[model samples]
Target: MVSGLLWPIIKKTGPLLMLLGLAAGGYWLNRHYREILTPDIALGERLYQQGVDGGGHALQGVTQNDIAFDDAQFNCAQCHRRSGFGSSEGGNYVLPVTGTILFKPRTFERADLFNKLFKESQGQVFRARMRSAYQRPAYSDESLARAIREGVDPSGRQLSPLMPRYRLNDTDMAALIAYLHQLSIRNDPGVDEQTVYLATVVGPNVDSADKTAMLATMREFVEWLNLETQGNLDHPNFSPGYRSDFAKAFRLWRHEVWELPADPRQWPTELASRYRRQPVFAFIGGMVNGDWTPIHDFCEASRIPCLFPFTDLPPTGHTNRYSMYFNQGLILEAKAMGRFLRAQKDPETRTVVNIHSGEPRSSQPAKTLTQSLHGDKRYLVVDLTFESIEQLRDQWQKLARQQSAPIQAVIWPGTFDKTIAAELPLLARYAERLLLPSPALEANQTRFPADIAGKLYFSYPYELPTAYHPHAFRVRAWMNTRDLAIENQRLQFNTYYALNLLQFGLEHVVDHFSRDYLLEYIENEAENQLNPGTFPRLSLGPGQRFASKGAYIVQLVNNDQRQIHPVGDWIIP
Candidate 1:
């Protein structure tokens, strides 16, 4: 009788167990579905930042305070590490939030929070569940937030016993959001304001009587600057439209000093005293035409860099406060030429003829052509000599006649003696030439008609600031640079790359005018902070960067037409 009674009790207990199991199962399914669909704002941020701008953490710059969340951890960097904040309770290395799991919420976004909750797998990552919580859905975002700060949920549901709400104040919440918003920033150090100032080199060029007065005025300006802005090189907190009356007067004075006649005495001393209180700054540079060593030495002693031809100068290691913004030696010119030639390929013309100037390797001159030349190949070796260029052309013509080769083109370097052209008849039609590579020739870029100059290319001795595209190069012509021939597709490709290197450096190293304006600008960096378009204009090529070492190559159409190009242009072996 006892056994029979036990069986009935066992049967009743089995039904109760089934009812409990089904309830538990239903709750889990709802929770899982919620987590998968509405993921979070952080997911979107991760995708946008990591993929765009070529990879890095995404920052919405949204701080915990922006959304009015109260937690010292709103920076999202502090808590669950990398900010997803979910830890598994059970499966593999699991410990879950012990409290209430509210549905997920998309944190830190202007969009409807619901849309940002789910994380969509990119590529195969979507298909495989892996360790990702994306499929299972994250912890109920609201429940989690409540659990962290308050021990209870919106429904007064007690959450993981481990968490207790520590009420936070309003001030702390605002600060948190502010910090997050601040964090989501792009760290691009673009060129600061295009500052302008006068640099004068006082010499015999100045009047003796005016010199003492000028010196006194300049020192005063220095004193004024020292007192004004605290010498910060970065942007000072000045509003956009403030009138720089004092600075304008100085800039106007700059034009006077820069364009000063051979004799400073020709100008009135009073005007000079009023604006020329700044230091005497010299334009130091190098080119083949003059002795540039002293200027080079002065600039080097000052650590100023220049994009000069491939010459090596040492650090100042000196007492001179001056510096040079450098232009590397002739190598920059050569590399620029290579980029120009590589861009100009047509199927019919596979051969490249680089006629550079160098000492003859043998007792007699021989053509040194790039061995890489192949297909549609052709080359011409025109040796340089004092004899009229006609003599050299006469010889080339004779050879051309014997070989029946259609002497396609001619490229000449400035390093050659132009008088040699009196002999060669083929180079007279230089304007019709297709390719000229050199900083100097390119300086006169726009003048060369792009229509006639097929596949023409050139490099700025110094490129523009952050010149990511060719539009900057097209604008360079307006900066008084020689207009370049954008002969169809070739120019569209090469000018931008060449421009990126040169222009960026020029703009970067020469941000300031001379040291005195710098000192004053520093003192008034806040007061005198110029916009990106401000003076010292950073203009290149309009004036021969006579101070910077630069060179160029020009092409001459192989014709008997009557105008010759610059000397020492390239010829093949």
Candidate 2:
């Protein structure tokens, strides 16, 4: 009786156990297949971006007309872009290769069709001219491989001749396909269905007025953007016969302020904590008195864009992809000074003195100039550090007494006050030329001593005041209408420009809402006309982090009038 009872129970459980065994075996087989097919994604990234294979060799491709090209000349990023979202240029539309766009079946809904037609015709095209929606099946791995090597789509249609045929081996092709499958598949943080969030960074020890101006301008712009978006949504003007597709792109803007700690060491912790609580899509119109390295590093590590911070001391070295600056800051000014001194036709033997207060803002440029002219036999570089105006005066007197050759002095007092301004004219008598950064003179233009106007020169990184910038009037009118005070023009104008640039970049991405896509748009489509007359021209391109590339060495002319005039053309060093 016991054996019979056990036998019945075993019969009931035998089928369940067999089914579980099959399921486990199936899962193992699937995983094994995935492991076999999936190659290293980094190799694929290099192939897509740098056009290099896993073996450190340049990948090769062929055009439809049998023209061969190497990776250096024809990389995927050159056309499809770093985001893999593709772009339209020179009358050709490059199809997006991101996994989100590629792996799914291709079919346009009625709204999407209308939007495309409306965009292409600028809202003038009629429905009678509409064509049937094109359709294609979802791409399988084998189909995608064929498409890459043979220029054929999953629907057996030949791709455009502009699409090059790559000669990727089995392993390399799998890696490239895997990379494409992973490209921009998920939405970045700080974006939702109806709103996108952004932040502005404020570093420690910044002037209260400047900080206020930057924040006010950005906040006002965000408020205006939300109001406009609401208006568009309320009056979408969508009809059965004619649809307003542009209304779909409207999203409310949410702005946040991130104030960094006074201690630089705690910046990363603070930034990470704030980001964890509430992430932002990008940073716009930041202001700091000192170096921007800490903030820049945070942005880079987080893969967030930091746009156009106001500072005279940006980090030096290789160009950073995530951080875009207005210019190279004091480094540019120092290089310009070096170029000016080298171009001078004065006596071969000369003494160049670089004096500062040992602060990064002051000492960094001095160091840059000294390093730039290190091996030159034409002149001798003397670096001097002073803590007070009295100490600087004593050093100046001692230098004047011992100087044998003509003296060219570049002084950065670190803090430009009335006391320093008063002492600059007296110190200028001892040097053939006394150089200063434009920011120093601009900060104290009202109390600037006219006696030093003749001997003093400035490294100017902006358009001369005499040139007409009609856009400045627009900026002023916008500020006046908003009831915002113009305490700091440079700060306010740059802040306004950064906001406008973010707005422009967002407009291009529409519903995509990818940080990489936004950055790519900024790199390629930043308009010069958007500049608010703070700089001569503001623009950017791929791999370019600095918008302004040159500076002018200027002199304060017409001492009675107190006008700043350029000594020569702009110098790009």
Q: Tell me each candidate's TM-score.
A: 0.28, 0.87
Which candidate number has the best TM-score? 2
Cα lDDT computed for each candidate against the true fold: 0.32, 0.81
Q: List candidate 2 segments past 4 Å from native.
A: 1-36, 107-136, 238-243, 374-376, 416-419, 558-562
Write model 2 residue lDDT over 406-445, tens digit each, in one string: 8888887666533566787777788878888877776665
Best by lDDT: 2
Report the error of model 2 at residue 496, Å: 1.2
> Which 10-residue window in model 2 sums to the lowest lDDT?
120-129
Residue 90 local lDDT, model 2: 40
Overlapping backbone residue pairs in candidate 1 total: 92
